[model samples]
Target: MTDARVPDRIAVRGLTAHAHHGVHGFERENGQTFSVDAVLELDTAPAAAGDDLTRTVDYAELAQRLHAVLTGDPVDLLETLCQRLADVCLADPLVEAAEITVHKPEADLGVPFDDVTVTIRRERAP
Candidate 1:
């Protein structure tokens, strides 16, 4: 018999990174800061009861992985970055699904804007 329970959610927010990723040449050469937010759907019940870090996602390590993607390559669109970020999150076999948002505060638009963000949600393939 299987429990077939929905997993608890774990969220990591406001993880910032400086990287050379953008559409314009200056934006790519000079680099800009990006803020990432991620949510992982996974079974945390075991970790909660046993007090074991191994049973759940290690967010610090996950942050490092997310940052690596940001710093590694230059992408023209925030949508691309969002998908790559989602891929990184879903790489963990234990993760059933991932929701991520990438925020670009310094977008090179002529008009004033508060912020620009792209969000994505992905579920593990069966």
Candidate 2:
């Protein structure tokens, strides 16, 4: 259950989007801002050596893909959204592993808090 493996990474952080994802009816109807952070584990040596965009992750496209996940579905759990986003990062063959974090800043927790976040890490099965 513990995946502490570390490797070179390409990261996209602090992406905010309004999404309709929650268990409560009010939360789904009203929607809220969700912050996401994605870390892709990959060897950047080739891209760095060649200075080729093709050899690396196109972050703009990745952002759009992640955004689509946020804006597309109405999942009831942040865990589901996190899993989907992790899969998006791992879509690239170059990515060996991924860590995805989703933060619900505007959650209806019935109390004041900074954030309620969910994080998941996935590695390609070897």
Candidate 3:
């Protein structure tokens, strides 16, 4: 069996997008800014040795896909948004695992808070 210890990772941080997602009606109608951080686990040796783009995850493309998802649909919970983002990262065959975080800074929480975030980790099924 191949080693399951994926030691390499690609990180995309502070990705921001405007979208409509929340439990409130105004949130879905007006939309808000969402911040995302994605970490993908994989073996990068093949891409490094061959110096090929296809051998590794194209982060630019990944960001675009994530942006699309953020602006695509309206979800009631941040957990659902995180899951959708995780799904996009795991779509690549080279990605062994994905960690996703969705941040909502402008949420309508009555209490004062810095930010609200949801994080999730997903691994490819064996």
**lDDT leader:** 3
lDDT-better candidate, 1 vs 3: 3
Off by over 4 Å in 2: 1-6
- For residues 1-126, write the lDDT of model 1, one tens digit per residue: 998887789999998989888889999899988999999999898898999999889999999999899888889888899899999989998899999999999888899998999999999999
lDDT of 2 by residue, 37-122 (tens): 99999888899999998998999999999999988879999999999999998889999999999999898788889999999999
What are the root-mean-square deviations of the candidates from the true structure over C-alphas? 2.3, 3.5, 1.8
TM-score of 2: 0.93
Q: Is candidate 2 or candidate 3 better by lDDT?
A: 3
Tell me how many residue pairs clash in candidate 2.
Answer: 0
Give candidate 1 misplaced runs (Cα > 4 Å): 1-6
Please identify model 3 stretches exceeding 4 Å from their true place: 1-6
Q: Write the per-residue lDDT of candidate 3 for residues 10-100, one digit (tens) a residue.
A: 9999999899999999999999999999999999999999999999999999999999999998999999999999999999999999999
Which 10 consecutive positions of candidate 1 have the poorest summed lDDT? 15-24
The number of clashing residue pairs in each candidate reads 0, 0, 0
Question: How does candidate 1 fare on TM-score?
Answer: 0.91
Q: Which candidate's TM-score is highest? A: 3
